[model samples]
Target: MNLLNCHQINELLSAYLENELDTTTTLTVANHLEKCLSCEKELKALTNVSNLVKTVIREADKTDLSLVARSNKINSLVKDEITSKIKATENLVLASSNDNSIKTSQNNIVKLNLRPKWSALSKKIFLSLAASVAIICLSLFTITYYATSTGPLLSGVARNHQFCSAIEISNIGWHKGYPKERLLQANNINLPKLDTLGVHFSDLHPCKVYKAPFLHMMYSKGDKQISLYYGSQEAVNKFQEKFKTITPNELYLHQESNLQIAAISTQKNNLWIVAGDLTKEEINAITSELAINSLSNTEESKLFH
Candidate 1:
């Protein structure tokens, strides 16, 4: 049977825990765990954590839906009322039939008064509920806006990939430590023979991803470019959960019209992402060659960057 290394073994842990891997892979992982203490600990940790999460979610699933449904009913009614009031607020003519209730015009014009003429208790309840909904919606919109603009470096990388020439290699200032030093700093291996892709190495820039410092490198190939981003675990953990986790151990590839991102986590939990607009062939070629060879063939495919 073929033995699996830590990287390949790590990817199989989730599936192995659930008994989803094929029989050969399962046996291989079991044999590997017996000899590899580090892989063994990591597997146990991940398994314990996953089981705990599953248990919590299972308990949460058992929660009575009637309670949720009742609350949702209240929110839904308020949302509808708010929607009507908002439409009414936009009308050219704003008038209220009575200060107590919401009223609408035949021609899409509606009248909404904050101080409703309804009875004292009910009126207060409606106003309070409306105010709460307003607060919730406002908060959500604010959060969404903030999240989109928060990652300027990441956003810029994504955006720049869309353009032909967003910046000169000099403008980004990639220089600093030697390639060996930068690779060491990131706890990753630099790919040899990247010249096959016509890469012009840029200086390693000191940067932050969500305020965690990491070195950034850019490689220009004519008008096209790609970025290899490194970030510590804590900072990178805040990214989309889907991107953070992967089914396969190799560099996980995600493509967009503007960019193609190949992101993976190192053994130390540091994140290394390579993004560009290369074709499937180019991406596969780059990823295949990106990692430095490990001591054994089993760990050869594990890419730190």
Candidate 2:
């Protein structure tokens, strides 16, 4: 009988030791081990290692409480040293004031002088100003760190021209292209022939018109259904205008599949198209059929560009 490899034996040893393998797999391993001397030796070594680990853990859990007490005593000594230093600083300030003329005059007279009052008030103001500066510095540092860390991720999402929006669709099944004739019958929108559109039947779905500034669509390709949108109408329109001179063939060559095919004349061009995941050929077909009637004037284009 052929012996199991070291890796295979290790797998069986782990499962057998953990008691995780089901009856059939366990029995298979056991039968192989009975005929394989090399596997039996590996299993024995693994068992010995597991036993040693358990023994070590049990001993570690029984550590003496005196060690913990000593650690706490060390921490207390460090805190007491810090408190003593602060008290010493306060005492030094009080002692230096006793030798000054301001303190001598206050001791000689019962009435409070305006000079001493002003000095005390000024000290308090200075301390308050210092604290405020520290807080502002800390806040700015934290903001800068967060912005630096997250900037790249945000830039990537923006570059992809991808955004998401929620739409209220009453029927999800209809959008998935299910019960096809029934859905078309109810909506009174004829199912555009799949071959005529040059797209597979599975790749299309009916989507509802949501609030603008966001364009929402529900479509399915094979088993996957996706809802996609652009972030803002202004951003979309700006991008479309930037690429106005770009022809369908040229855009296809550049593989700029994220842009949608525009279907409006220049004057009434409110909706900007945003594309998602379509191949170059598919994008070319769509844009050829849906090109804008007029390109933006050179003067207007220059303003945005």
Candidate 3:
């Protein structure tokens, strides 16, 4: 037969477990599994997941649903069909073990008879159950991932601004780490000079906003300080989604402690946040200016090139 890569083997694993592959392909997969540890581990994990889903389905049938008489009757019929299939599979495995004509390998691959073809109604029920399982799995994965990544970065940005603003008022100098120009160029962010808006750049330090790199630019207008934070689109999208109240380029307004904050995306979709001890109007103005200026710079660069 043919040599199958890990990805190919994975694609066949479900069918192989179901005794749906022809004998030659089944033997090939078995041989591959004996020699390949990664594919073997994957097969084991898939088996566990499959068994878990089956157990969940079985337990679901045991739930009391007497109030909904029609649904209860349907669940009863489905449970009976599933139980019969499980018993038939067990019997087939036992018969395979006892058959003298069947060949067995050292890796415990015993060929079994093909599964009996399902009736049309049986196929529909099985497919509907499979679809429900798939939907549940996808929803769980999305919720877990979103919860871990979003809803915290905005608070982190606000806290960073508050801490740094206090230090700036004390006349403390920021640590000069990476040069500002190189950082901006590497990240493809345009930090516009806000002299027109009375916000003058005071200092910039490279800092981590959660797990992503952020260019934290400090600005001053007399005694008032403003923070302009720029980071990647991926990081900012999560923060924006947490608020669930902004269009593509609209600003998200938030506050932490005494610091008022605003965030918006540039026309190029890069994220920018403006935060300070200012009113809603001031924070919104600074955020809009940064976004508009950054958008203009992007267009200008494209035109110049």
C-alpha lDDT values of all predictions: 0.58, 0.47, 0.65
Per-candidate TM-scores read 0.34, 0.23, 0.37
Task: Give the lDDT of residue 260 in candidate 2.
Answer: 39
lDDT, candidate 2, at 50: 92
Candidate 1 residue-wise lDDT, 1-305, digit = tens: 49566898998888988899999989999999999999999988997898899999988877867777888999999999999987776652345434446656688655555663557889789999999999988875554434322234235443432311222122232323444464544544443346776776754454444444455566778887777665566645644343434422333445323455665444445555666766666665665555532112323223332
Q: Which model is ahead, 1 or 3, in terms of TM-score?
A: 3
Model 2: lowest-lDDT 10 consecutive positions: 296-305
Q: Highest TM-score: which candidate? A: 3
- Hey, what RMSD does candidate 3 come out at? 31.4
Residue-level lDDT of model 3, residues 38-66, one tens digit each, is: 99999999999999999998788768566
Better of 2 and 3 by TM-score: 3
| Winner by lDDT between candidate 3 and candidate 1 | 3
Say what the RMSD of model 2 is.
29.1
After superposition, the stretches of candidate 1 with alpha carbons farther than 4 Å from their true spots are 1-193, 210-212, 240-257, 265-268, 293-305
Cα RMSD of all models vs. native, in order, equals 37.0, 29.1, 31.4
